[model samples]
Target: MPKGKRKGKFEHRRTEEKIYSSDEDAGIDMTIDNCSETSGQSDLKSAHDDAENEQEKLEEKVLEMIDALSARSNAARAGAMVSLRNALQRRHLAAVLCNQRATLADHLAKALRRGRDGERRAAAGLAPLLALQIGEEGVEEFVNEIRPELAAAAADKSASLETRTEVMSQTFTYV
Candidate 1:
């Protein structure tokens, strides 16, 4: 057989050649052909399974971090809250967190109310992201639950301006 040619059962024949006007056209054609080869239902199912597995792992990690919020070391607790806040940025993770919004919010609120300065700051930062993850109705409920405490904290002259501002902005503005 000649180069770039194939033999059939009956006889040897020239393969049809595709002509492209530009390298970009050639690239597009190659992409289309490659895509067709991998566009089977199995490929889609496998991709979906992978996505679900990743989501599960992410959810597990977020839960672990939330548990870590109660660690004896302030640094560990602050780190966990920060991690939870970062995880909330992912929509899938956020949805998972939202499922436990009441528990999460209550825990963070306690931290904001009674923890040391660093823990309070971490809780302050995570509060808005938690509200956003829980959606409008959930956020409204959270705000209602914490509104009085937040107002008290905001008005308390002893509280640092940053802490008061965090409480007011995160609770009221976001809700």
Candidate 2:
């Protein structure tokens, strides 16, 4: 052996082969994974936000239909009732409408009392739908709110026989 040189088969091998350290590679991989995870979470959040926005638009439209029930024109009130019924059938608005059942009952009763034949018939048609949406618990409240007007409309001789019969049948269904 020389003064500065040591004999070893492994010592020469170390200089010839590349050394791999896991720390550097792991740091880069972890950063990439973190970025992807953050982006994925953001995408999910955006999707959730879009769904909530869509639900809000639906609820607003239903509320507008409810307000339209009070329109002065008989045709408009009848149209609103039909539209409201269509919307209810298309969407499950239980959560959105549960809070507004009383207001809905009031409008429906008023329509039954003061509206023309078509409007009263449409209003009568809507009672069962409202009861269905309000579920078992709040149905009594809705029934109570509208029952008097239902009774009046059912017995009103001036209304067409069809209207009175429809009102009577609807009243029986609810009671």
Candidate 3:
């Protein structure tokens, strides 16, 4: 990163130094050496770490929200859970998410079983994202796990129109 000139009292370099800690600095050396012209490594690492930490904090907050909020209140808990689960897309958490892929996938299906239309759509969407992290083949596993119940749910007019549509859409991809 360029170390010169700033418009303020604090040096721009010092401001940057504080953003990426030594751990991120050291971890990025290999990438920096190989691809020297890429965006500043420190800045990328800092952004990644900040994003991961924020997700973890948010997931913790969701767990708290889930426990504190009534389960019957689908909109509230579903919103929290959807955002919490979507963090699986990050590479840093890929292994952890992959390890929990079956559980996560299963719960996603169960959410369809128990969720409102919007929540069901959100949960069904998580399957493909989890499959990308786990493996393309896991899409079959996800489909096998969820299909029976969703088929039943789709038959039920009581099911959300959106949930029925999302479940139909998922069939084309995973099945």
Candidate 4:
């Protein structure tokens, strides 16, 4: 996916099989669009093709991990996502990460649609990274997009405190 596509804030469901890119600048995105779902077959094919096209072992590893995460079990999916996101940034898979932005965003949007607690929190982490290249104003727009939900969420105790804290803190980042 292109970096520009994930700009601002958005939503997605978190899942073990979902593939999230680590290009997030500040964290989760808040942009809303009629994001469509893509086929698993295509995502699998894309990851496979990425591996074949890249000779760099490190880049290949990123693709390999993405493929692996795409099929991971739900019990381990959230942790797996965090690991993948961390790897994207920590391993510096800038080229592939930038290229996979669309796929990642699609998958993320789907995750948010799932409406699970874990998925939302995982999605939150991507907002910052999504708008990183777009600069602060974009980030502000992104944060403002999701602030209401975050604030309202903070008032609810059923969700994880991390979710509320992340969202509320996001308000500070944008405001």
The most accurate candidate by lDDT is 2
lDDT tens digits, residue span 18-91, model 1 = 55578667565544444554567779889999998988888888889878977888778888998887777655
- Leading candidate by TM-score: 2
Reference-based TM-score, model 2: 0.69
Q: Write the per-residue lDDT of candidate 3 for residues 68-154, one digit (tens) a residue.
A: 323566676577556655555433345445445566665666677777787777766665666666655465675677777666656
Please give the lDDT score for candidate 1: 0.72
- Residue 85 lDDT in candidate 2: 91
Please give the clash total of every predicted structure, in order: 0, 0, 0, 32
Candidate closer to the true structure by TM-score (higher is better), 2 or 4: 2
Flag the better candidate by lDDT, 2 or 3: 2
| Span of 10 residues, lowest total lDDT, candidate 3 | 62-71
Question: How many Å off is the CA of 20 in candidate 1?
Answer: 15
Q: Once superposed on the true structure, which residue ranges of model 2 sit more than 4 Å away at CA?
A: 1-49
Give the whole-model CA lDDT for all candidates, comma-separated: 0.72, 0.88, 0.63, 0.55
Question: Which residue pairs in model 1 clash with each other?
Answer: none
RMSD of every candidate to native, in Å, equals 9.7, 11.7, 14.7, 29.4
**Between the candidate structures 1 and 4, which one is better when assessed by TM-score?**
1
Residues forming the 10-long window of minimal summed lDDT in candidate 2: 25-34
The reply for model 1, stretches above 4 Å from the true place, is: 1-39, 92-94, 156-159
